[model samples]
Target: MKIAKLSLLFLFLGSFLFAQNQKFTIAEAVNGLRSNLAVKNISQFSWADDGKSYYQSAKNAYMVTDLASHKGDTLVSLYQLNKNLDLDKKLKTFPRITFITKDKGYFTQDSNYFWVERSGKDWKVRDWINIDKEAENIEMLSDNEGFVYTVKNNLYLNRNGKIVAITDDSEENIVNGQAVHQREFGIEKGIFISPDNSKIAFYRMDQTMVGDYPIIDWSVVPAVNKNIKYPMAGTPSHHVTLGVYDIKSNTKRFLNIEGDPEQYLTAITWSPDSKSIFVGVLNRDQNDMKMNQYNALSGNFIKKLFEEQSDKYVEPQHPLLFFPNSNTDFIWQSQRTGYNHLFHYNVDKGLVAQLTKGDWVVTEVLGFNEKKKEIYYVSTQVSPLERHLYKVDWTNFKTQRLAQGVGMHTGILSKDGSQLYDFYSNATTPRVVNVINTNTLKTRNILSAENPLKNYDRPEIKNVTLKADDGTPLYGKIILPTDFDANKKYPVIVYLYNGPHAQLVTDSFPASGNLWYEFMAQKGYIVFTMDGRGSSNRGLKFEQAIFRHAGETEMKDQLQGVAYLKSLPYVDADRLGIHGWSYGGFMTTSFMLKHPDVFKVAVAGGPVIDWNMYEIMYTERYMDSPQNNPEGYKQANLLDKVQNLKGHLLMIHGAQDNVVVWQHSMNFLKAAVDHGVQMDYFVYPGHEHNVLGKDRVHLMQKVTDYFDEYLKK
Candidate 1:
């Protein structure tokens, strides 16, 4: 009778727990997030030269809104523009506007080859002559009479009554046009148009040497494999070469930079005079990098302005800024000082001057205002946990905070660098976007002020710094339950993603947390994440300390975090579990496999089982080639350490992950199976690296059930 009463009591609690865990629907959560989604997610907003009006994309058309009057008018339909100058005149009736110009008013068009110019609300068709050619990439360059367009990857000049091909290289491998994925994902456009349409520097990605990885498409009648040139880790990546085309002479010449064929030519930009083009070349190991300059027309190597070397790795993400009204100068961001700092180099003398120096790292280089001799950028200087906008004098390095907020803030300065549009947010405060004056640091107008998660109850998130085994400072965060109790002992879940280019502990409210952490906390689980060594926002040395041993150093920091959590009187060490996705997933599984006694449960999602399975660009920089560093590769492979697995491990992966690939999870699954290790597994069919939409709900529910079953009750 006593056992039956206890069983009834347990049954009631289980029912209540299940009900509580399944309160919100995925659609409801998505809807709520979407409704309160950051309003300042403006992709590309252009202001008029006078700064009186700005053009923004809304719905299907580009709308020009007057900042002074708050009045907006439809400029063009972005979907209606074509390259062959074949635009349907019918699109004009639909308020079609692709892009607008300040001096030329508005540019409107439809998919066919019809472009119209609007002056004072009056529209006039500028180009209506339909030739027997199919238009593809139509672009309006400057306020000049001639417009630049491309047909079948061949650039052309369309003006008055003549259409001339500036680039005749229409071969399959020698593409002279712009590519979407190359531009969007790689954040670089294949085409570079000169300011005055005198020359064009375009990217030519020769994939003829690349081996194609087959992608299976099961949606067809007979599932067929599609060939894609996916350069895996340690493999020969696609060769990218820059080609400069002269519009007047219709001549094309490739820049002759001194480097190996496999070396990466990144951050290609034209000097102020446009006579020379600058290129940063990085070797495969990514340890050595050089900034080379070459004549745009003659293709002659001009000068090697700046060079950087690191014991582990070096990255060339910052663009070389050419100061106006000066002959010998360019700005570069480097981690040579142990932290990412700005440096000015003279082209004539090849002398480098450190512009900004500190322990804080510059997150981004917004731009250099030559007139004021000031450099504006975003950095984590205020506090490593939060990012803020800052302006510094290029000469004296006098720093000033543009947006004085105790949160993650980002801003976009006007074209003239007089005004800035700022967005600020934190874990508790929703994002707010406002226009501010750069000189006075005063806000002009608030574009948006809405709380994304105002309705939902938010957890109390706090930052905590812990010491690693070597006594190095490690930053971490803990998200407490809505109704947190310090007296009760709770199971702890350590969220991790301690990769070189990642930082989990931040002031910004984590979008992935949702009710999941809250649900866990409600079930008496302590959730925490630590930005271990090799994580981003830290100095180059701090980040590269784990080179060749990605998990070794990170695992130490994480274990330190675990020890810190264990020190908390309310933390149940026996019920400790670790969870991570991608790189974090690798670390989690590696931790559990390496130290199984420390963790009771672990979940590694879409993890890279071996470093050999990752992408060449990122993987080679840290772990080198698998052939060269066999021991390092062996150490990175969690499969090799699977024998130490004693925890209840749950492995999850998307069936069609092209990034980490499903093969990684499959290999681990096979290894665990062969080793007679009991493990739980799940796969989201037709999902890629990240599982979203309706399927994500099921995934979260599964994760919740897994953690609740093992770590909670």
Candidate 2:
């Protein structure tokens, strides 16, 4: 009787454990991210501030190793961190720790700041009130020095326990310490600190001049009008100015840049001495840009280094990269020769030499090694589909490959650039992180992530290469449905975003780069995505092939993909669907109008129906101005071609989309009504550009259902 009771108790424990572990669902996968379903990964692997030691992190623990000795020890214990802190909530894992000095480290638990100091056999923690609770984009200089943050729409500097307001503007339209120019020219942040961190420079965008676009809130008792600052094309744009703040004086001064107020202020950079600041000031027309520098203290214009002008437009995405320990020479990224390459420039000597040149483009510059006079970067030197890390020696300008195997490899270099923590992922490999000693070229494997969705009904994703109309090589990825059979035919779903600066067909894991594609594959749809002409990472010839004709070449190239899809024995040509977002949305509509009989169904999200309605920077770069290229605008406009759309097309928007604007879709609906074209429409309330978060599952479900109802015959 005693043994039977013990067995019953064990069975009860097993049932309780089983109840706690729930099976993953579609909603759980989309919303919760099924955090428990994520692949076990190396949490935070970084070279310590000392440069001689590095740390590899886990959930609750971290291991630090000395490079010279290859000896490692537990650096921080989350258990100890929790014990030292007093809080209402108990922490589960280690915080985001950043080592400032040899002994001091700072971390954050949500928004609360914690500074931990190392003692002999114990760790001491303290709660500091130097940081603002409402601060955003906090860039700290040191442990106790100060930090720069933005609250609401203004800039603030919290220094040595006192918070100083930089911009006291009460208007939300006057945005400070944020990226401007609709996020073009690679302006992601408004804050740029000096090397010494004594002064801070930030962008001040005054969008009060722009028009207000109102959006309604249907979810509320009474729909309210929420107006957004939208600077449309061929209209009055926002004026931007660069301001510098001195910590000692707590004063602000704007740079004396000579240009129209509505012109673009991009590629913000600081001198090594912090005495000067540089900016790429483009004109209102955006066809020309003057790379100029100014005095940081006096706020006076220094000199114009160089100028770039194009009949179409000149876009400056990268900033000035100064040489290590030297301020005289710097590297600049330009696409003057129809290809983006690196150019070495001397402030006094003018253009010294072009460091890198070829048909390929240098995607990103990692860092520079001062001792060895080498700079590391990732480029499309091998192939446009793959990105590999390479080191270019400054002496001879010879390049050496650093990354092993294929796919996109990105790395974080040490302060001295002698060591690197490399991270990579590909279609086959889930993830692989490594530590490399640059001097000896010796590398050690740190962590390799396993396939997280191994238990799911994954599809067979493979890379497909097809030729464009002009015989140019186009790369694409196709997902065969789970339990795919050769005898039975399957419907095709052409998923694409065949626009500039986006290459969907990459050697990335989950092979399609989106889990939604696999989810649709589980529903038995053969998904396809290709990077046609005018897509990024390829040479300028390929990307600019659609110049003056945005949707023409991309559509024709996609037709080549369709021709290849029809050639496949398992593909059903009668039931075909197409899906694209933004530029892809533009292409999807264009294909339906151009082909007519090819696609049976299509779904477009936030697509640009007319180039004139798009932003100035991006639209003008390819199609020039609406005033100049009226024919290109007329040809690409889907508004007039609504009569040609034979497929069942569905256009979805964020309702308040500021990028493409809702007017693009609203205008299309007006034309559709005039032409009496039947179509489907949906909108996600309070969404902009794209419908994200948990609601995105609903968006995809709506899209899947549209194709299922029409094409899944």
Compare the candidates by TM-score and give the number of the best one.
Answer: 2
Give residue 19's error in model 2 in angstroms: 21
**lDDT for each residue of candidate 2 in 1-713, tens digit (9 for 90 to 100):** 99999999999997776654334355544543336555556767677765798877765767788877888888878777777667864567667777765467887765667778788767777765545677887877643577788998999887767778989999899999988888898888899989878789999999998888876676688777788776655668889999999887878899998768988998899999889999999987777999998999989998999999976667788999998999889999998987888898988778988888788899999898998999988888888877888889887999898869788888889888888888888887888988888888899887798877655667888889998777888898889988699888999999989898888887766577777787778788899988999998887788878877899888889889999999999999998999999999999888888788999999999999988888777887788777877898899988888999888999999976878888899999999999988899988878989888778879888998898899998
**TM per prediction:** 0.84, 0.91
TM-score of 2: 0.91
For each candidate, what is the lDDT?
A: 0.73, 0.84
- Each model's Cα RMSD: 7.2, 4.8
> Tens digits of per-residue lDDT for model 1 on 233-328?
777776777888887787888888766777777777777676888887888777888888899889999878778888777777766776666656
Task: Report clashes for each candidate as comma-separated counts.
Answer: 18, 0
Error in Å for residue 81 of model 2? 2.1
